[model samples]
Target: MTRRTLHAIRHVGFEDLGSFETPLRTAGYQIEYIDAAERDLGQLEPLAADLLVILGGPIGVYDHDSYPLVADELQLLRARLAADRPTLGICLGAQLMAAALGARVYPGPAKEIGWSTLDLAPSAKSQPLAALRDVAVLHWHGDTFDLPQGCTLLASTPLCRHQAFARGPNLLGLQFHPEVRGDRFEHWLLGHASELATSGLNPVTLRHDAKRYARTLEQAGTVMLNDWLAKLKH
Candidate 1:
Protein backbone atom coordinates (compact mmCIF):
# COMPACT_ATOMS: atom_id res chain seq x y z
CA MET A 1 0.00 0.00 0.00
CA THR A 2 1.19 3.48 -0.80
CA ARG A 3 1.47 5.94 2.09
CA ARG A 4 0.45 9.57 1.90
CA THR A 5 2.92 12.16 3.16
CA LEU A 6 1.99 14.52 6.03
CA HIS A 7 4.36 17.44 6.33
CA ALA A 8 4.02 19.10 9.75
CA ILE A 9 5.60 22.52 10.04
CA ARG A 10 6.48 22.62 13.74
CA HIS A 11 7.38 25.79 15.63
CA VAL A 12 8.39 24.52 19.08
CA GLY A 13 9.21 21.03 20.24
CA PHE A 14 6.84 20.42 23.16
CA GLU A 15 3.79 21.59 21.20
CA ASP A 16 4.21 18.63 18.87
CA LEU A 17 1.47 16.43 17.43
CA GLY A 18 0.02 15.29 20.79
CA SER A 19 -3.17 13.35 20.00
CA PHE A 20 -3.07 13.97 16.25
CA GLU A 21 0.07 11.96 15.44
CA THR A 22 -1.11 8.47 16.20
CA PRO A 23 -4.24 8.81 14.13
CA LEU A 24 -2.34 10.13 11.13
CA ARG A 25 0.17 7.29 11.34
CA THR A 26 -2.64 4.76 11.71
CA ALA A 27 -4.31 6.26 8.67
CA GLY A 28 -1.10 5.51 6.71
CA TYR A 29 0.52 8.94 6.50
CA GLN A 30 4.30 9.26 6.59
CA ILE A 31 4.95 12.17 8.93
CA GLU A 32 7.76 14.65 8.36
CA TYR A 33 8.71 17.30 10.89
CA ILE A 34 10.17 20.59 9.77
CA ASP A 35 11.43 23.05 12.38
CA ALA A 36 10.60 26.11 10.37
CA ALA A 37 11.22 28.57 13.19
CA GLU A 38 14.88 27.66 13.60
CA ARG A 39 15.68 26.27 10.16
CA ASP A 40 15.76 28.01 6.81
CA LEU A 41 12.47 27.96 4.85
CA GLY A 42 13.48 29.86 1.71
CA GLN A 43 13.89 26.73 -0.37
CA LEU A 44 10.64 25.09 0.83
CA GLU A 45 8.35 24.34 -2.06
CA PRO A 46 4.59 24.68 -2.42
CA LEU A 47 2.10 21.83 -2.16
CA ALA A 48 4.95 19.53 -1.11
CA ALA A 49 2.87 16.84 0.49
CA ASP A 50 -0.53 15.17 0.41
CA LEU A 51 -1.37 16.93 3.68
CA LEU A 52 0.22 19.96 5.30
CA VAL A 53 -0.34 20.69 9.00
CA ILE A 54 0.91 23.81 10.74
CA LEU A 55 1.31 23.45 14.49
CA GLY A 56 1.06 25.96 17.33
CA GLY A 57 3.86 28.08 18.82
CA PRO A 58 4.54 30.99 21.19
CA ILE A 59 5.54 33.63 18.62
CA GLY A 60 3.13 35.80 16.65
CA VAL A 61 2.82 35.62 12.88
CA TYR A 62 3.56 39.34 12.68
CA ASP A 63 7.03 38.86 14.14
CA HIS A 64 8.54 38.05 10.80
CA ASP A 65 11.66 40.15 11.48
CA SER A 66 12.43 38.27 14.68
CA TYR A 67 11.39 35.04 13.00
CA PRO A 68 12.20 35.43 9.32
CA LEU A 69 10.95 31.94 8.52
CA VAL A 70 7.45 33.28 9.16
CA ALA A 71 7.59 35.07 5.82
CA ASP A 72 8.59 31.98 3.90
CA GLU A 73 5.96 29.91 5.72
CA LEU A 74 3.28 32.48 4.86
CA GLN A 75 4.37 32.47 1.24
CA LEU A 76 4.05 28.68 1.19
CA LEU A 77 0.63 28.92 2.82
CA ARG A 78 -0.54 31.45 0.26
CA ALA A 79 0.37 29.11 -2.53
CA ARG A 80 -1.32 26.19 -0.78
CA LEU A 81 -4.50 28.15 -0.16
CA ALA A 82 -4.55 29.41 -3.71
CA ALA A 83 -4.21 25.86 -4.99
CA ASP A 84 -6.84 24.62 -2.53
CA ARG A 85 -4.37 22.07 -1.16
CA PRO A 86 -5.33 20.05 1.90
CA THR A 87 -4.11 21.94 4.96
CA LEU A 88 -4.84 22.23 8.67
CA GLY A 89 -3.72 24.91 11.11
CA ILE A 90 -3.77 24.97 14.90
CA CYS A 91 -3.38 28.12 17.05
CA LEU A 92 -0.37 30.05 15.72
CA GLY A 93 -0.71 28.07 12.53
CA ALA A 94 -4.32 29.24 12.27
CA GLN A 95 -3.28 32.85 12.76
CA LEU A 96 -0.65 32.45 10.03
CA MET A 97 -3.28 31.10 7.66
CA ALA A 98 -5.44 34.14 8.39
CA ALA A 99 -2.54 36.51 7.75
CA ALA A 100 -1.62 34.69 4.54
CA LEU A 101 -5.18 35.16 3.35
CA GLY A 102 -4.86 38.95 3.87
CA ALA A 103 -6.60 39.14 7.27
CA ARG A 104 -5.42 41.08 10.32
CA VAL A 105 -3.64 39.07 13.03
CA TYR A 106 -3.20 40.81 16.36
CA PRO A 107 -3.43 40.54 20.12
CA GLY A 108 -6.84 39.99 21.60
CA PRO A 109 -8.46 41.48 24.74
CA ALA A 110 -6.95 38.78 26.99
CA LYS A 111 -4.80 35.68 27.00
CA GLU A 112 -7.19 32.78 26.80
CA ILE A 113 -5.64 29.69 28.44
CA GLY A 114 -7.00 26.43 29.85
CA TRP A 115 -9.75 24.09 28.73
CA SER A 116 -12.65 26.09 27.35
CA THR A 117 -15.61 25.36 25.15
CA LEU A 118 -16.28 27.26 21.93
CA ASP A 119 -19.76 28.35 20.92
CA LEU A 120 -20.17 26.87 17.47
CA ALA A 121 -21.67 29.12 14.89
CA PRO A 122 -24.94 27.99 13.27
CA SER A 123 -23.42 27.19 9.92
CA ALA A 124 -20.47 25.40 11.59
CA LYS A 125 -22.71 22.76 13.13
CA SER A 126 -23.11 20.75 9.94
CA GLN A 127 -19.48 19.66 9.60
CA PRO A 128 -16.74 17.81 11.53
CA LEU A 129 -16.62 20.56 14.18
CA ALA A 130 -20.00 19.17 15.17
CA ALA A 131 -17.82 16.68 17.10
CA LEU A 132 -16.54 19.56 19.23
CA ARG A 133 -19.92 20.98 20.19
CA ASP A 134 -19.83 21.63 23.92
CA VAL A 135 -16.34 20.10 24.08
CA ALA A 136 -13.86 22.16 26.08
CA VAL A 137 -10.49 21.84 24.40
CA LEU A 138 -7.18 23.36 25.44
CA HIS A 139 -6.86 27.13 24.88
CA TRP A 140 -3.30 28.45 25.17
CA HIS A 141 -2.82 31.53 23.01
CA GLY A 142 -3.39 35.29 23.29
CA ASP A 143 -3.22 36.34 19.65
CA THR A 144 -6.28 36.25 17.41
CA PHE A 145 -7.10 36.87 13.77
CA ASP A 146 -9.97 38.25 11.77
CA LEU A 147 -12.11 35.88 9.74
CA PRO A 148 -10.51 35.53 6.34
CA GLN A 149 -12.58 36.46 3.31
CA GLY A 150 -14.85 33.65 2.08
CA CYS A 151 -14.01 31.48 5.11
CA THR A 152 -16.70 29.91 7.26
CA LEU A 153 -16.64 30.81 10.95
CA LEU A 154 -16.56 27.47 12.73
CA ALA A 155 -16.29 28.29 16.43
CA SER A 156 -15.85 31.21 18.81
CA THR A 157 -15.15 32.11 22.43
CA PRO A 158 -15.91 35.16 24.56
CA LEU A 159 -12.22 36.06 24.57
CA CYS A 160 -11.66 35.49 20.85
CA ARG A 161 -14.13 36.12 18.06
CA HIS A 162 -12.49 34.01 15.40
CA GLN A 163 -11.62 30.69 16.95
CA ALA A 164 -11.95 28.45 13.93
CA PHE A 165 -12.32 28.99 10.20
CA ALA A 166 -12.79 26.70 7.20
CA ARG A 167 -12.40 27.48 3.52
CA GLY A 168 -13.82 24.69 1.41
CA PRO A 169 -12.87 21.04 2.14
CA ASN A 170 -9.13 21.63 1.78
CA LEU A 171 -8.38 24.29 4.40
CA LEU A 172 -9.19 24.30 8.11
CA GLY A 173 -7.81 26.52 10.86
CA LEU A 174 -8.41 26.21 14.61
CA GLN A 175 -7.41 28.59 17.39
CA PHE A 176 -7.83 26.09 20.24
CA HIS A 177 -5.76 22.93 20.84
CA PRO A 178 -7.98 20.01 20.14
CA GLU A 179 -4.81 18.06 19.45
CA VAL A 180 -3.63 18.54 23.05
CA ARG A 181 -3.57 15.44 25.23
CA GLY A 182 -4.04 15.16 28.99
CA ASP A 183 -1.03 12.91 29.45
CA ARG A 184 1.31 15.33 27.73
CA PHE A 185 -0.19 18.63 28.95
CA GLU A 186 2.57 18.93 31.53
CA HIS A 187 4.93 19.59 28.64
CA TRP A 188 2.94 22.70 27.79
CA LEU A 189 3.02 23.87 31.40
CA LEU A 190 6.77 23.42 31.48
CA GLY A 191 7.30 24.79 28.00
CA HIS A 192 5.38 28.04 28.54
CA ALA A 193 6.32 28.67 32.17
CA SER A 194 7.00 32.36 31.67
CA GLU A 195 3.90 32.89 29.56
CA LEU A 196 1.84 31.25 32.30
CA ALA A 197 3.39 33.37 35.07
CA THR A 198 2.96 36.60 33.14
CA SER A 199 -0.59 35.77 32.18
CA GLY A 200 -1.48 35.18 35.88
CA LEU A 201 -2.81 31.70 35.23
CA ASN A 202 -2.68 28.96 37.85
CA PRO A 203 -0.95 25.77 36.78
CA VAL A 204 -2.84 23.76 39.40
CA THR A 205 -6.18 24.89 38.04
CA LEU A 206 -5.13 24.14 34.48
CA ARG A 207 -4.02 20.68 35.53
CA HIS A 208 -7.33 20.06 37.25
CA ASP A 209 -9.26 21.23 34.21
CA ALA A 210 -7.10 19.12 31.95
CA LYS A 211 -7.91 16.09 34.02
CA ARG A 212 -11.60 16.91 33.80
CA TYR A 213 -11.91 17.97 30.16
CA ALA A 214 -8.99 16.40 28.31
CA ARG A 215 -10.82 13.12 28.14
CA THR A 216 -13.66 14.80 26.31
CA LEU A 217 -11.17 16.14 23.78
CA GLU A 218 -9.59 12.70 23.49
CA GLN A 219 -12.82 11.29 22.12
CA ALA A 220 -14.12 14.35 20.34
CA GLY A 221 -10.79 15.28 18.81
CA THR A 222 -10.39 11.84 17.35
CA VAL A 223 -13.81 12.10 15.82
CA MET A 224 -13.11 15.57 14.48
CA LEU A 225 -9.70 14.81 12.93
CA ASN A 226 -10.79 11.47 11.53
CA ASP A 227 -13.78 13.08 9.89
CA TRP A 228 -11.52 15.73 8.40
CA LEU A 229 -8.99 13.20 7.06
CA ALA A 230 -11.84 11.19 5.60
CA LYS A 231 -13.05 14.25 3.77
CA LEU A 232 -9.58 14.77 2.30
CA LYS A 233 -9.69 11.19 1.06
CA HIS A 234 -12.87 11.90 -0.85
Candidate 2:
Protein backbone atom coordinates (compact mmCIF):
# COMPACT_ATOMS: atom_id res chain seq x y z
CA MET A 1 0.00 0.00 0.00
CA THR A 2 1.10 3.53 -0.67
CA ARG A 3 1.95 5.71 2.34
CA ARG A 4 -0.15 8.80 2.81
CA THR A 5 1.21 12.00 4.31
CA LEU A 6 0.01 13.10 7.76
CA HIS A 7 1.02 16.67 8.62
CA ALA A 8 0.54 17.56 12.27
CA ILE A 9 0.75 21.22 13.30
CA ARG A 10 2.40 21.09 16.69
CA HIS A 11 2.55 24.24 18.83
CA VAL A 12 4.71 22.88 21.65
CA GLY A 13 7.26 20.06 21.73
CA PHE A 14 5.52 17.83 24.25
CA GLU A 15 2.03 18.36 22.82
CA ASP A 16 2.90 16.09 19.88
CA LEU A 17 0.62 13.28 18.77
CA GLY A 18 0.88 10.76 21.59
CA SER A 19 -1.38 7.72 21.39
CA PHE A 20 -2.39 8.55 17.82
CA GLU A 21 1.16 8.17 16.41
CA THR A 22 1.39 4.38 16.41
CA PRO A 23 -2.01 3.84 14.80
CA LEU A 24 -1.36 6.50 12.17
CA ARG A 25 1.89 4.73 11.18
CA THR A 26 0.23 1.33 11.17
CA ALA A 27 -2.41 2.76 8.83
CA GLY A 28 0.36 3.66 6.33
CA TYR A 29 0.81 7.36 7.05
CA GLN A 30 4.25 8.93 6.86
CA ILE A 31 4.08 11.50 9.63
CA GLU A 32 5.52 15.00 9.30
CA TYR A 33 5.71 17.54 12.11
CA ILE A 34 5.16 21.20 11.34
CA ASP A 35 6.28 23.07 14.41
CA ALA A 36 4.03 26.12 14.40
CA ALA A 37 6.73 28.23 16.05
CA GLU A 38 9.81 27.19 14.06
CA ARG A 39 8.41 26.47 10.61
CA ASP A 40 7.32 29.02 8.04
CA LEU A 41 3.69 28.06 7.55
CA GLY A 42 3.61 30.45 4.60
CA GLN A 43 5.94 28.11 2.74
CA LEU A 44 3.82 25.05 3.50
CA GLU A 45 0.92 24.12 1.25
CA PRO A 46 -2.31 24.02 3.20
CA LEU A 47 -3.88 21.09 1.41
CA ALA A 48 -0.74 19.15 0.55
CA ALA A 49 -1.20 16.35 3.04
CA ASP A 50 -3.75 13.54 3.05
CA LEU A 51 -4.45 14.40 6.68
CA LEU A 52 -3.83 17.46 8.87
CA VAL A 53 -4.00 17.35 12.64
CA ILE A 54 -3.81 20.48 14.79
CA LEU A 55 -2.41 19.55 18.19
CA GLY A 56 -3.26 21.12 21.55
CA GLY A 57 -1.39 24.18 22.89
CA PRO A 58 -1.55 26.83 25.60
CA ILE A 59 -2.31 29.70 23.23
CA GLY A 60 -5.73 31.27 22.87
CA VAL A 61 -7.44 31.81 19.52
CA TYR A 62 -7.85 35.53 20.08
CA ASP A 63 -4.12 36.02 20.71
CA HIS A 64 -3.32 36.36 17.00
CA ASP A 65 -2.16 39.97 17.41
CA SER A 66 0.44 38.80 19.94
CA TYR A 67 1.30 35.48 18.27
CA PRO A 68 1.39 36.02 14.51
CA LEU A 69 1.61 32.24 14.01
CA VAL A 70 -2.05 32.11 15.01
CA ALA A 71 -2.90 34.16 11.93
CA ASP A 72 -0.86 31.83 9.71
CA GLU A 73 -2.62 28.78 11.12
CA LEU A 74 -6.02 30.37 10.67
CA GLN A 75 -5.18 31.19 7.06
CA LEU A 76 -3.95 27.65 6.47
CA LEU A 77 -7.01 26.12 8.13
CA ARG A 78 -9.43 28.28 6.19
CA ALA A 79 -7.96 27.05 2.91
CA ARG A 80 -7.88 23.38 3.92
CA LEU A 81 -11.30 23.47 5.56
CA ALA A 82 -12.86 25.29 2.63
CA ALA A 83 -11.85 22.31 0.52
CA ASP A 84 -13.19 20.00 3.28
CA ARG A 85 -9.98 18.01 3.49
CA PRO A 86 -9.62 15.50 6.34
CA THR A 87 -8.68 17.55 9.42
CA LEU A 88 -8.53 16.83 13.13
CA GLY A 89 -8.17 19.44 15.85
CA ILE A 90 -7.57 18.88 19.54
CA CYS A 91 -8.02 21.44 22.39
CA LEU A 92 -6.53 24.74 21.24
CA GLY A 93 -6.46 23.18 17.80
CA ALA A 94 -10.20 22.73 18.08
CA GLN A 95 -10.61 26.36 19.07
CA LEU A 96 -8.57 27.37 16.01
CA MET A 97 -10.72 25.24 13.76
CA ALA A 98 -13.85 26.81 15.24
CA ALA A 99 -12.43 30.29 14.68
CA ALA A 100 -11.55 29.37 11.11
CA LEU A 101 -15.08 28.11 10.62
CA GLY A 102 -16.48 31.47 11.73
CA ALA A 103 -17.34 30.48 15.27
CA ARG A 104 -16.55 32.42 18.43
CA VAL A 105 -13.83 31.03 20.71
CA TYR A 106 -13.11 32.41 24.15
CA PRO A 107 -12.30 31.52 27.73
CA GLY A 108 -14.74 29.29 29.52
CA PRO A 109 -16.38 30.04 32.87
CA ALA A 110 -13.80 27.85 34.58
CA LYS A 111 -10.69 25.95 33.65
CA GLU A 112 -11.56 22.34 32.93
CA ILE A 113 -8.52 20.40 34.09
CA GLY A 114 -7.99 16.76 35.07
CA TRP A 115 -9.77 13.57 34.01
CA SER A 116 -13.52 13.49 33.41
CA THR A 117 -16.00 11.42 31.46
CA LEU A 118 -17.80 13.08 28.57
CA ASP A 119 -21.51 13.05 27.96
CA LEU A 120 -21.62 11.92 24.37
CA ALA A 121 -24.52 13.01 22.24
CA PRO A 122 -27.00 10.33 21.33
CA SER A 123 -26.00 10.61 17.68
CA ALA A 124 -22.39 10.28 18.71
CA LYS A 125 -23.05 6.70 19.75
CA SER A 126 -23.11 5.84 16.05
CA GLN A 127 -20.13 8.04 15.26
CA PRO A 128 -16.39 7.46 15.81
CA LEU A 129 -16.60 8.67 19.43
CA ALA A 130 -18.66 5.64 20.37
CA ALA A 131 -15.49 3.90 21.51
CA LEU A 132 -15.14 6.57 24.20
CA ARG A 133 -18.41 5.73 25.87
CA ASP A 134 -17.93 5.94 29.62
CA VAL A 135 -14.16 6.38 29.20
CA ALA A 136 -12.59 9.28 31.07
CA VAL A 137 -10.33 11.51 28.96
CA LEU A 138 -7.94 14.24 30.05
CA HIS A 139 -9.45 17.72 29.97
CA TRP A 140 -6.71 20.39 30.09
CA HIS A 141 -8.14 23.31 28.17
CA GLY A 142 -9.59 26.53 29.60
CA ASP A 143 -11.00 27.90 26.36
CA THR A 144 -14.18 26.90 24.58
CA PHE A 145 -15.85 27.56 21.24
CA ASP A 146 -19.34 27.91 19.95
CA LEU A 147 -20.62 24.99 17.89
CA PRO A 148 -19.78 25.84 14.32
CA GLN A 149 -22.66 26.14 11.89
CA GLY A 150 -23.52 22.84 10.17
CA CYS A 151 -21.40 20.86 12.62
CA THR A 152 -22.83 18.07 14.73
CA LEU A 153 -22.23 18.23 18.47
CA LEU A 154 -20.47 15.03 19.53
CA ALA A 155 -19.73 15.28 23.22
CA SER A 156 -19.97 17.70 26.13
CA THR A 157 -19.25 18.26 29.78
CA PRO A 158 -20.91 20.40 32.44
CA LEU A 159 -18.24 23.07 32.12
CA CYS A 160 -18.15 23.32 28.32
CA ARG A 161 -21.00 22.79 25.96
CA HIS A 162 -19.05 22.35 22.75
CA GLN A 163 -16.63 19.69 23.86
CA ALA A 164 -16.55 17.98 20.48
CA PHE A 165 -18.04 18.69 17.11
CA ALA A 166 -17.86 17.28 13.57
CA ARG A 167 -18.56 18.55 10.09
CA GLY A 168 -19.50 15.52 8.03
CA PRO A 169 -16.82 12.81 8.09
CA ASN A 170 -13.84 14.91 7.07
CA LEU A 171 -13.58 17.31 10.00
CA LEU A 172 -13.43 16.69 13.73
CA GLY A 173 -12.65 18.94 16.70
CA LEU A 174 -12.04 17.68 20.20
CA GLN A 175 -11.81 20.09 23.15
CA PHE A 176 -10.12 17.54 25.40
CA HIS A 177 -6.80 15.69 25.34
CA PRO A 178 -7.68 12.24 24.23
CA GLU A 179 -4.30 12.04 22.50
CA VAL A 180 -2.27 12.29 25.72
CA ARG A 181 -0.01 9.33 26.50
CA GLY A 182 0.32 7.93 30.00
CA ASP A 183 4.11 7.59 30.18
CA ARG A 184 4.77 11.08 28.85
CA PHE A 185 2.02 12.75 30.91
CA GLU A 186 4.62 14.31 33.23
CA HIS A 187 5.53 16.67 30.43
CA TRP A 188 2.07 18.18 30.69
CA LEU A 189 2.28 18.68 34.45
CA LEU A 190 5.73 20.24 34.29
CA GLY A 191 5.15 22.19 31.10
CA HIS A 192 1.97 23.79 32.41
CA ALA A 193 3.16 24.00 36.01
CA SER A 194 2.47 27.71 36.18
CA GLU A 195 -1.09 27.32 34.96
CA LEU A 196 -1.73 24.47 37.37
CA ALA A 197 -0.32 26.43 40.28
CA THR A 198 -2.36 29.47 39.36
CA SER A 199 -5.51 27.35 39.29
CA GLY A 200 -4.63 25.72 42.60
CA LEU A 201 -4.63 22.29 40.98
CA ASN A 202 -2.10 19.96 42.48
CA PRO A 203 0.06 17.86 40.19
CA VAL A 204 -0.13 15.01 42.67
CA THR A 205 -3.86 14.65 42.06
CA LEU A 206 -3.48 14.87 38.29
CA ARG A 207 -0.70 12.28 38.46
CA HIS A 208 -2.92 9.92 40.38
CA ASP A 209 -5.76 10.39 37.90
CA ALA A 210 -3.42 9.78 34.99
CA LYS A 211 -2.40 6.47 36.48
CA ARG A 212 -6.05 5.49 36.79
CA TYR A 213 -7.51 6.89 33.56
CA ALA A 214 -4.72 7.43 31.01
CA ARG A 215 -4.44 3.77 30.03
CA THR A 216 -8.16 3.49 29.39
CA LEU A 217 -8.17 6.70 27.37
CA GLU A 218 -5.16 5.48 25.39
CA GLN A 219 -7.00 2.34 24.29
CA ALA A 220 -10.30 4.11 23.66
CA GLY A 221 -8.61 6.97 21.88
CA THR A 222 -6.85 4.55 19.53
CA VAL A 223 -10.13 2.88 18.69
CA MET A 224 -11.84 6.22 18.11
CA LEU A 225 -9.05 7.48 15.83
CA ASN A 226 -8.89 4.25 13.84
CA ASP A 227 -12.62 4.23 13.42
CA TRP A 228 -12.56 7.80 12.19
CA LEU A 229 -9.70 7.01 9.81
CA ALA A 230 -11.48 3.99 8.35
CA LYS A 231 -14.50 6.11 7.53
CA LEU A 232 -12.67 9.04 5.95
CA LYS A 233 -13.87 9.88 2.45
CA HIS A 234 -10.40 9.70 0.86
| Best-performing candidate as measured by lDDT | 2
Q: Quote model 1's TM-score.
A: 0.97
Q: 126-207, model 1: which lDDT tens digit per residue?
A: 7789999988889988899999999999899988889999998889999999999899989989999898898888999999
Instruction: Enumerate residue pairs that collide in model 1.
Output: none
| Alpha-carbon runs more than 4 Å astray in model 1 | none
lDDT of 2 at 74: 93
The lDDT of each candidate is 0.90, 0.95
Candidate 2 off by > 4 Å: none
Per-model root-mean-square deviation over C-alphas: 1.2, 0.6
lDDT by residue (tens digit), candidate 2, 1-234: 768999999999999999999999999999999998999987789999999999999999999999999999999999999999999999999999999999999889999999999999997988999999999999998889999998999999999999999999999999999999999999999999999999999999999999999999999999999999998986
lDDT of 1: 0.90
In candidate 2, how many clashes are counted? 0
Span of 10 residues, lowest total lDDT, candidate 2: 35-44
